[model samples]
Target: MAPENQPTTGPSTFIGENYHIWVIKIKAYLKALNLWEVIELGEPVVQPLRVNATLNEIKKYDELVTRSPRALTCRHSSLTNVMFTRIMTCEIAKKAWDKLKEEFEGTSRVKSVRFLALKREFELLKMKDSDSVKEYSSKLMENVNQIRILGETFPDQKVVEKILISLPDKFE
Candidate 1:
């Protein structure tokens, strides 16, 4: 029987808008299922000379092959039909993950462009008159997180300073 905490259904479909969030969620799901290593490092190559191997070694190899296909199935089940089709040829979970990353996360040049745009958004972020302090903080944090994920580092003090500067005069 499955554990009470284990999800019986797969994660939501990914249509490409929030790849970062989707990746994080899917990774957590895979990790929970003990399938993340296969998606990251890939399946191990089996030795043909294993005919002389010990029984325990053979059992371990069998376990690996069994896990690989299950991981592949998990990967396919989590994606949309179109996205799944793109990675259907992938025999291993890692290959399918890499293909999805390359397609949705973009190349280095594209990432650089995205980083610059996110930076601009961060710079322009200001607490609107209608927004509460919590709402403003949430918006700021989201931009900060996206910037960090794109490989830009902002010191905590710098983020605090940005938040302070963005506040309305009432907070002064």
Candidate 2:
């Protein structure tokens, strides 16, 4: 659902088009509010399911984690542990960081933090390192929180925000 006056077609609807509108859409979608609700409240509505679905698909291995706890704890722990470790290595982290960099270019780019921070965060989470995990998780979670705040502050970039808001917890 796009807003009444906002254009939906052409380049205006791109994921990184306008951060303000994207953020607004994110807040509404995060609250589980639909287009009808937004319209009723005199707010613009926009659907960002395209980007959301693509991003959600990034968790291709998620199904492997939802199996029985015993299976995961006993058999899969080592495997998953190793997988996440590999994902966090400098090589893999660099690739992912590059992809994100390409996705959000110009003013939308969030490449302020160093690549090592992301690698360390993923490593701590994978290893279940209590102290390290707490630290990295806090930092990563802070970034996510900032995104949410952006969604709240911007009224037009609702679609982009909604797509970001639907991001799933990696380990949950």
The candidate scoring highest on TM-score is 1
**lDDT of the candidates, in the order given:** 0.84, 0.36
TM-score of each predicted structure versus truth? 0.80, 0.17
Off by over 4 Å in 1: 3-9, 48-55, 128-130, 151-156
Q: What is the lDDT of residue 125 in candidate 2?
A: 35
Candidate 1 clashing pairs, residues 3+ apart or interchain: none
Q: Residues 69-141, candidate 1, lDDT per residue (tens digit)? A: 8888887887888778899999988888899998988888999999999889989888998888899989989
Candidate 2 lDDT over residue span 1-172, tens digit each = 7776543432222233454454344334323322222222332233333455654554533432222222212211222343334324323222422332354432333433433344344334322334354554455565444444433232334434433443445434
Cα RMSD, model 1:
2.8
Model 2 bad stretches (over 4 Å): 1-131, 152-172
Clashes of each: 0, 12
